[model samples]
Target: MQIPVNQKFRLLSMLGEHISMCIIGVPLMGLSLLTHGNWGFYFVLVLYLNKDFLNGRSPLKRLLNTQVQQTTDVPANEWQCFLRNTTLIIWPLEVLVVAINGRRRLGDYLANTHVANVSEDIGSWKKELAAYRVTSYTFYTLLATGLYLLLVHTLFDWLGF
Candidate 1:
């Protein structure tokens, strides 16, 4: 089934979140190597597990004025957050699943939640700005940059350069 345009935005937002994690993670991984400490690993582990709760919003979702909500319209609880985030371990496959399921990835199906672009929830001129498609493209640009960083990290590791 063809995904709705709005759902497309949400899907892109999800992908942006994954990319953002990688962008943030590679640097922290470097720090971990430098210090010979697992601090970065633990930090990212917490973030990976509780992304939806980081300051009451997932970073990328907040940027897009979107949030994950249960089908019943309640805020997703911690358990739901953990369940959905498990799929993030295979983020690329998660994107494909979201595309095929029209925005509901396997974890979303299990968690019984959906990502919503709730501009009205922001309550400011920021809501007006989010209405523009440029904002989404900007997010996509950030995602591309994050992917580039991840690729470079992988190449350097593989080449031992």
Candidate 2:
């Protein structure tokens, strides 16, 4: 299906959210491995599920100047947000549905919400874009640091040093 230009931005924002989570999550996974706990996975899941909070603008949406609002012109409540995100647990299906319908995923349909750009103002978008760059850089730095630590630990173990 052909998604409109604006919907494409929403899709990109959603994808970016997942990618950012992974950037932070990979390091958390390494920590979980070293600590022998599942908290890292749980923390990621919570963040994913709650990504529509903060007055209809989650971190990812804020970065992209997008907001998830109900079709009724009201902010989506927590229940709606959670219901929509439940499909995220089975991400392949969620992504497939989104690919088929850019305007609304299964979660959006279920929750009666859709993502829209917050405004047409260039200034808002520029500010959000700047923030997005910083967020991306931070995530990359954390991922790289985690990888380095894991490598050093492995090397020490291998050499018995």
Lowest-sum lDDT 10-residue window in model 2: 1-10
User: lDDT per prediction?
Assistant: 0.64, 0.65
Candidate 1 local lDDT, 1-161, one digit each (tens): 11123657757777677788889888998899899875675567557756874222576767676667777655565556666776665778878886776767777887897776564455443553364344343454445445544665576679995
State every prediction's TM-score relative to the real structure: 0.66, 0.67
lDDT of 2: 0.65
| Segments of candidate 1 deviating more than 4 angstroms | 1-5, 54-56, 122-161
Report the Cα RMSD per candidate: 11.5, 11.7
lDDT of 2 by residue, 35-151 (tens): 987567656766666666445567766666667778866656555666677677567776677777766788888888877665535245346446443334345444544554466
Off by over 4 Å in 2: 1-5, 120-161
The clash number for model 1 is 0
